[model samples]
Target chain A: MKRKPSIVVVASSGGHLTQAMCATSLVKRDLVLVSNKNMLDGSHFTRVYTIRDTQYNVLIHAVNFFVALKILLKERPRAMFSTGGPICLPFALAAKITRTRFVFLDTMSRVTELSNSGKIIKKYGLYDSFLCQWEAVANDSGAEYHGQAFDLGDHGHQ
Target chain B: MVKPLILVTMGTNDYPFTRLYNAIKNDSLYTDNRCEWFIQTGSCEAPVAPACGVIEKIIPRADMEDLIRRSALVISHCGIGTLNLMLKYRKRVIFVPRVAAHDEFSDDHQLQIAREIKNQRMKVVFPDDQFPLLDYEQIKEDNKLSDPVDITNYDLAEIINQKLTG
Candidate 1:
C-alpha cells in the first residue's frame, strides 16, 4: 500500500484559516492544518500543528521556523497551500528546502497590491504558483487570476 | 428589557483595536444605553470606558455565530473573519480599519482592506474621519446591504487537487 501525498495547509487563525479552508475544502488527498491554537473548530484536519502566535517578534518567528521545520519533516507534504500571515514565511521556506511545491494565494482583501505575505513570498521566490483574487492585481504582478479566492460559506466541510 | 443587539468585534487578532471602541464609545449610540452592545474585544484589555456594553475578551465560536445571527448591526475591524460573517448573514456592517501608527497592527493591511471594501461601495469609516455617527445614520437610512461578490463556487480543494494530480 502506498501512502497518499500530503498537502500542508497553513494560515493564521481566524479569517485566514477560514479562507485557506475554503480552498482546501475541495482536496481529496491527505491534508494537515497548521496555525495558532484554538483557531479552528471541529475536526476537519487530519492532524493539527499549533505554533506560537508570533506577532512580528523575531524570537518567536525563529521558534515558529523550527516548529514548521519539524512538522514539514514529519508530514513530508508534497505541496503547501497557504493563505498567509507571519506563519507562511516559515512554512514557505521549509517547503522550498524540502522541494515541496509552494502555493501562495493573495488574500482577497488586497485589491491593488499583493499582501505583505504575498510580497515576502515573491521576494524570496518561494511560491511555485502565485495567485491573486483580483484580476487587476494579478495582471500587475504577472500572477494567475484565480477568480475569487475567499468564500465565507465554506466551513471546511466537503 | 430587549434592546437591539449591536455586535462589535476586533476579530481574533491579538492586537487591541482600541480606536474602534473609542470611536464607538464617543458616538451618540454609546450614550443611549437602549441598544444592547456585545463586544468581542480579542486581546484588548477590558475597556476603561463605561460606554462599551457587554465586553467579552473572546467568545466561543458557537456563541459568536449566534451573536452574528441575532445582531441587528455589526461594527467590526476589517478582518476577513468578521467581513465573512457580515456578508454571509448579509448583516449591515460598519467597517473600521486598525492603523499601524496607533500600535494596533504591525502593518496597514486592515486599512487596505477597508479601502477596498469602500471601493466596492460598502460603508467604511477611517480613523482620522470625523465622528462616525453621521455616516452610521446615513447607512441606516439607506439600508443598503449589498451581497458580496459571488465566489462560493470557487473551491480551494479542487484547485489543489488539480495541481497535485495534473
Candidate 2:
C-alpha cells in the first residue's frame, strides 16, 4: 500500500513544540516530527525523530544537517513546518535544499522580535512562508501575522 | 481528605532554573504538610526533596497532563507549552518567566510572553516581584478534578493549514 505524504515539523521540546502542535492542529495530512526531546507519550505525530539540540553551534549544526538530509529524503514530506529554537536550523536548511515547502512560525515567546533561528531563516530566505505570532514582530520583520497558537485573553475565564 | 496537589514545572529547556527552585523552596508552604507538591525540574538538579511531595527531573507529557488536570495550583516557567496546558485545563497558575540575566534561559523572551498572559486565572511573577504565598484555602477550593478543553486556535490553525497544504 502506498503511504500518504507527510508534513515534517521541526521544533524544540517545549514552547516551540507546543506552538507547532497548535498551529498544525488543523492539518489533515500525516505529520512527522523532528524535535530535540521526546516528551510526548506517542499521541501527536506519525513518527518522531530526535535530533541534537543546539544554539548556533557550528559543529552540532553540521552533524544535524546531514541527519536532516537523511530524514527529509526518507520521509519525502509534502511540506515542512517549524516553530523554532536553534535545532530547527538544520531542518530549515534541509527543507530548502530538498525544495520542500517550508512554513515557519516564529515562536509566540518572541513578542518584540523573531527568534535567533527565525532570524537566520528569514535572512537566508529558507522559508516559503514565514509567520510571526506577534503583529509587532511581523511588522518589523515583514513576516505574515496569524494571531497566535491559542487565545491569551480574558474571554475564557469562569 | 486528600491533600491538594501543587505542581511546579520548570520547562523542558536545557537551562537550569535554580531561581525558581529556590523561590519555591523558600516558600513557607515548601515545608508545610497542608498540601502535597509535584515538581518537574527538567534539566535542573533535584538537590533535595520536599517535605510533602515528589520531585522528578522530568516526567512524560501524558503524566504532566494528568497532573495538571488534578492540580489545585500550578507554578511554571513562562514556556508556551505549560501556558497552553494550563489554559486547556483552566487551572490557576503563577508563571515565572526565565530571564537571560539570571541564566534561566537563552533570552528575555519569556518576559515578553509573560506580558501577553491576560488570563484571569494566570499570574505573572516578574524578576523583582515575589512568588506570592501559596494560599491553602484557595488551593483547597480549586482542587476539583477537571478535563482539558480544546484550547487550540482553530482559526489560526486553519490559516496555517491553508498555507501548508497549498
The candidate maximizing lDDT is: 2
Q: Which residue segments of model 2 deviate by more than 4 Å? A: none
Best by DockQ: 2
Q: Residue by residue across A58-82, what tens digits does model 2's lDDT show?
A: 9999999999999999999989999
Residue A18 alpha-carbon offset, candidate 1, angstroms: 2.1
Q: For candidate 1, what is the lDDT?
A: 0.73
What TM-score goes with each of the models?
0.83, 0.97
Superposed Cα deviation of residue A70, candidate 2 (Å): 0.4
The candidate 2 chain B region of ten consecutive residues with least summed lDDT is B144-153
lDDT tens digits by residue: candidate 1, A34-85: 8886544666678788888775688888888888888888988878888887
**For candidate 1, lDDT tens digit of each residue in B1-166?**
3456677888888788777778777767766655667888898775554453688888766678778777667788888777766666666677888788998877787787676553232468787776456343433443433333444435555675577545
Docking class of 2: medium
Leading candidate by TM-score: 2
**Residue by residue across B73-130, what tens digits does model 2's lDDT show?**
9999998899888888889999999999999887898999899888788999999997
Q: Compared with the real two-chain complex, what DockQ does model 2 have?
A: 0.76
